[model samples]
Target: MFDISMAEWSQNAPARARLLLVGGLVALTGVLALVFSLREPGSIAIAEWWPAASAAVAAALCARKHERPYVAVGVVLLVFLGLLSGGRSLELSFLDSVGNAVEAWLVAAIIAARRQQLSLKTVADVGRLLVATVAGAAVAALCVATGAHLVGLDFAASFVPIAAAHALTIVCIVPLVIIPRLHFRVSTPPKTIAISGALVLSVLAAFYPGSPAPLTFLPVPILAWAALSQSMFTAVFQLIGVLGGISALTIFGGGPFAYVTGAVPGIAFLQLYSFTLAALALLIGAAAQERRVIERERLALASLVRGAFERGPNGFAVLQEAASNWFELIEINAAAPALVPDSFEHSAGQWRLQRASRLHEIISRLSAGTEQTFEWSAAPGAASTAQLTITVGHQPNGSRTVVLAITDLAPMREAQRKLEEQLARERAISNELRKLNQQKDDFVASVSHELRTPITSILGYAEDMRENHGVTADEESLEVIERNAMRLLAVVDDVLLISRRNSDTSEPPARRRIAVGRAIDQCVSDLGRFAASKSVEVHVKVAPDTYLYVPESDFARVLSNLVTNAIKFSVPGATVKITADTKGDEVMLEVEDSGRGISREDRDRIFDPFYRSPQAIRDGIPGTGLGLPISRDLVHSMGGSIGLKSVLGEGTCVEVRIPLVRPEATQ
Candidate 1:
């Protein structure tokens, strides 16, 4: 048979090197002792001691292995040696020796039970465990008596005191072992307090003298509580208490002879056999708990990783680089599963084997944690307006997680196409409006040229008649003709300006960086005479050093139009406030009127071309109805914007924001 006992994996056994080292040291020590004791120089006396040395080595191996069967065999070997020393005269009784045999069985049983617990999962299999504790203690007691009998000692008298001492020991140390095993799911404070209390009680009990003669049944109540608790940890702990507490009590007793050298107090001899049983049992229980925890932790970790893998936003695959050389789609999310539902072993429809794919190289580097993100535009015929991004996970090897976030091109693309179509239509309409304005300008120029000669002639004749002919006149008729002609001439001049100046190119728009405070001041100064005619004043409120980059003429036109409207709409003596300030790089200018404000519904439409407010219509205000729109156009052309805000009764404020210099622009 193969020598399984000599295998490297043998439990707790020393290695060959250890054994050899120990043997050499022991040999040297024996020589030293012989030389010292006798005061003579001599070689080690090995010739007479070969068998004993061999036996000792074997015993050491048996004990170090901590296997129950090996231990039993070792014990039998020792007993055999004892019998050999005494010869046939060393007689023994079968019934008296029964206790020793039973104790051996109990010790073996407890050791095997603990090993099984460490290897097995379910607590339903602790049958040997239940048998080992009580049975082992009783059997140990019996062995001490049997050994006492064999030695021609007073077995009965010694057994009672020793067993009582064992019981006291059991009561003391058992609780210490058991408290650690109760893995109760409670708050930490309560558990700490409870474990400490148990330890204190056990220690006290151990030191106390006097208890039942046999401690065989002392651990029963705790074991019962353990079984009722249905906690494997609890059960193991209680077993520990039963085993360790009792063993400590016994081992600490007056024992060096234990079972063999029965020369010391009987208490010492009693503990030797009993304490061994406790050690074996506790070791087994602890090993079992460790195994259970390791298994549970492994399973819990697997569950957690699997959950993240399956529920994450993107699809994941594990690609093997073998003869199969294919990606196995491992997990897919609810949103993206339909697109990358499963992997293909070989290329099917659109898929192709790429000899060198940048995508693949990128993924390889990402999986190695060399890169976090890889961005690339969509492939040809793919959505043109969107891009793809791939972010890598931490794990190495396998195909890197490929996150394909594709934006749909339908809405934005369609909107852009529609915008182009609308722009074309607007361009055509703009061309038509420009032609109409050109025709109106031509007609006004023609009418003014034709009417200017006759008006000059009539004015000249009237002046000539007043100066040269000295005729009697009706004062009222004369005043009426002069006043009416002057009024018609003024109206004609306004019509000419409105029709022609809109398209007239003057000095190529004159681009410059104009301070908004200066701009507003200029507008007020230019329109001061007009405001004076209506008995209205224009108030300029502007912070200093506010600058903007714009075509000076366009900005000036915007200011001129807004201030003109403010003065026109305001009541006489109502001041128009024109304010200017800078927000970052943009110059914000405002013209507020204290006249009747525009209505909420009309505010937006008032900026439309040819649009007039209801209040202006009701008041019969004479306007071209192109002021706000023209102002908006001029402002936007100069990289600026205009807007109007008002309450129904409160006055109106026309706001214009023009861009600053390129170096100063915030955007």
Candidate 2:
């Protein structure tokens, strides 16, 4: 025996399942055919009405397109065997089986062509099934009639019964099998039991012995009730029970259907009644199920909206617009009561009084259906305010409604106030620092001015003594005093220059077109003694025609400072070179020195005032750290830039670029 749950069968489930289904369908079709077939010779047209027809169509529909060929062959062979066993001749049985198989395949093909699912859940689904059933039944009936005519039976007399029987069978049986395949929540037991009891009672009353002929319609209401109030499954199940009861009672010659004059007419009437009940139950059940689904979705959406409205932080109010230009409060969410504590009527009256002008504007523009925002105080003249944003919309009946949302502005205003206070404090601190810096610059200027006169007097007296008392033993001491005095004067001059630059009262010196080569020569000459003392050679390379548009004094100061710095940092016998030339619209001046070069770390702030390098401090180099700053300031005041490039332990180069004076303009 094969284990069906084995991996092989599981993997081949589709192919295996279809094979099993085909085999089962063959067995079911054959059994239903034999059980329901009529043995009367004149009842050949009723072959399509057999239970085998329903089973054949249902199996064809259940089979996929690729599996239908095998299913179709099985249906034909099964129906033929069943017909033969029921005493039909071989030729007629084969033809009738062909018609039945064609009918089943036609129904399946029509549904597939329409791309409809097999389940009936909506009115449209019922309509699609109805259409497919009618079409398949008519075609099958014509085919059966033709086969009967070929066998010398009357086609016109046979087509109607064949068509009616096939259509009724499909309508009655297909949904019974198809609808139960869909999973549905079972109807509540109370309603299910109540409707079930009602249907059973109705069927028993209509089909009981000696019942009147019109009493057969009694079960219609019960079927309709089940359709409207019960699940689709319950409704369809009740329909099947009613059908079964009527057929069974009539077959026993006991029901209202059995009272009809002729057996054939009674069965026809029975089939008509059954078809009506099936249509009623299936159509109404499908519509009711669709309505339930829509209602369920609507209720879920309403709950979600209610949750958002109640839990939201913003205060919300719904108001109806009135003819008197006043809003009538209609509803409020959970947050609105906090913002509007007083009775809404009283608050609304106050709003109309206090905000009359804006209210008039709002009323005038509300018909345009735009959102407007305004500031509102809870009470008149209150400090804290809330922002009200109102959106206007029309209701379904053409009445206008306004949705107003309130957001408190007090916290935002408080944050803005604190930010302003912090900024004010920062501005005040910055202004005070500026004032103190100005005072310090003034003090330096005052002291440098005071020291310059004495330094000049000492230098003059010392020089006079050296000239007058020549060959004296103290001549070298006189020279030392003069040199020290000159150094003191230079420091005082640098301090005064810095003070003037920092003071707002001091204006830049008037610009003069000065020759770059002459300026370079003057700087080198001024530093000649300093460079000679260190045994550093000063080399000058400049294009004599390279002139700059700058203050003569500022230019002289800049070149002198750069050369002085270069000389001071130079190694003994290492050359200090000053070069200048005009490039593009500017004059470039570079002072290169073979010195213990500034390190990468110190190079960034080499021109900052009073910022001495770590290397210079470590080596005990004598510098007030003012030369480079003063140079930078003077160069900037002349609208130029200064930069330095250096490699530690290699030579350092200080480059300056100043706007060059054209020769024609200078002349």
Give candidates' CA RMSD values in order: 23.7, 11.1
Tens digits of per-residue lDDT for model 2, 235-285: 877787888877887777767667678525666677777877888888998
List model 1 lDDT by residue over 489-521, tens digit each. 545644544555565652335577777788778
Which segments of model 1 are wrong by more than 4 Å? 1-326, 331-362, 365-367, 370-386, 396-400, 408-415, 474-476, 506-667
Task: Give residue 126's lDDT in candidate 1 (0 to 100).
Answer: 34
TM-score of each: 0.29, 0.55
> Judged by lDDT against the true structure, how good is candidate 1?
0.51
